[model samples]
Target: MSYPTIPAYQTQANGAEKLSREHPVLDFLIDHQEAFDTGKMKTEPYTVFHVDDFVFTKSDGTVLPPGEASWKGLLEGYAPFNKHYHEGRYACIYERNGIWEMVGFANVYANLLVPGEKTKKDQSGRQWDVLVPGAFLFTCVKDPTGPKGFKVKSMTLFGDGVPVVGEMMKRGMVKAEDLVK
Candidate 1:
């Protein structure tokens, strides 16, 4: 079998998977994502979220701030679902003066945890993959107390959730009222 050659420009944009491993901070984040992809978040990436004051905000103005709720909420939400980090392109990634940042577009493949009423399934009743798109910004700061001497302080996820939400609603996995502001 043969594979097509990727252009240099394209390879550079999709270098998240090829980033040099010498940088510990970026490595930390990558490790976390890898753990999530392989369904080992509960054990492997658990400590990556040790930042007690971490904040996660979505593009839709939804915010999960420190003390309001912890990463445990995220764990619970993902506990019932199977997700795999399909691909990502980090348009920008750098570190300076103890701060590390990355901005990129990512796709995650997931399936409905439970069979939905209108879910599209195969003859074997296997649900199809849901490709979730996300444009994200991750900012990390040096923290001696953090598990890796660094921690993710804030994360901003920019994306059009409508498509995925619409799909979910169609599959009977979510209701219109559930997404109401």
Candidate 2:
């Protein structure tokens, strides 16, 4: 078996698996379309949502942007390309009940972080991988060099990050007043 890599296709594969972000997520969403569901699906990549102050980050200790970066060169050591979990550099933000909260992550893969994982470090004294995560999601297109342009038209949600934040706020760990503005 062989997969055809179009030198010039409708969409370029910078990272995300399918042709577009909507295809997979939409497929998954179709099943639960009745639910007040606004999130990506399992097919998409994912990362973790740590219980940070007001921001969520990947396990590497660096802030994972929300979406994918157009140029691989744009991805820095702080935000690695292949190492990055979501697409573009933008996390998915949803305003629920007048709250501009981050409902999911898009730029990097969301599922990387799971519960009970421990922080691992490398010889450079920097974190290599994060073990624990609150949620996961997927971004679209990491690289594109054709007419379509490499990018994720839609982002998908996986695991569960919203509840993580909600729990934090409810537990008095995170301040809702700071975000509910």
Candidate 3:
């Protein structure tokens, strides 16, 4: 598929909730999500790219098939640490918006979007690595309504995912916040 479908996410994934107790960074972030006075979300990050600038060739000068690492889908390689990765959900990281905090997310798994079977060398030059393009995922978009102080927004992306969305996706993954530590 030229573009990946958006992923479905909840405030707490199946595994992320457990990890929140382990560290403060994860705890406060997950428990207390920052919202506007009416509980409107301030953050709306939605793009990701790899560290490398879409390089199809390896340092050794080898070509690779597409899907080497796609930003479009959850890379299967991350399967082993699904729980640990989900913990990233608690990471209430945000992008800068005129010095104000934006939205909070469970995790933003940004990486290289390499085609399948591509080989790339790390800075250490010790081994080959597959690249996954960066991607932005939000827990949910809050739309508060009524006196009860409630809201309902789409938790999952609707329809097919577009590789680039407006200007955000075109910007690529440049911000430190967009990447996973």
TM-scores across all candidates?
0.66, 0.20, 0.18
Error of 1 at 82 (Å): 3.0
Count backbone overlaps in model 2: 32
Winner by TM-score: 1
TM-score of candidate 3 versus the correct structure, residues matched by position? 0.18
lDDT of 3 by residue, 62-123 (tens): 43333323222222323312111112232232323311121333332222342222243333
What C-alpha lDDT do the candidate models reach, one value each?
A: 0.59, 0.30, 0.27
Q: lDDT tens string, model 2, 1-181?
A: 9995422212223433332334333222223221211233222322211111113243334454443431111222213112323223222433234222323323222112223222444222434233122233322332233112322323223334454454345545458787677
How would the candidate models be sorted by lDDT, starting from the highest? 1, 2, 3
Off by over 4 Å in 1: 1-22, 43-47, 67-80, 116-128, 143-149, 177-181
Backbone clashes, each candidate: 0, 32, 23
For candidate 3, give the lDDT of residue 5.
Answer: 44
Q: Which portions of model 3 show Cα errors greater than 4 Å?
A: 1-92, 95-118, 138-181
Measured over all alpha carbons after superposition, the RMSD of each candidate to the real structure, in angstroms, is 8.6, 17.0, 18.9
Q: Model 2 off-target regions past 4 Å? A: 1-148, 166-171, 175-181
Residue 166's C-alpha lDDT in candidate 3? 19
**In candidate 2, residue 95 scores what lDDT?**
27
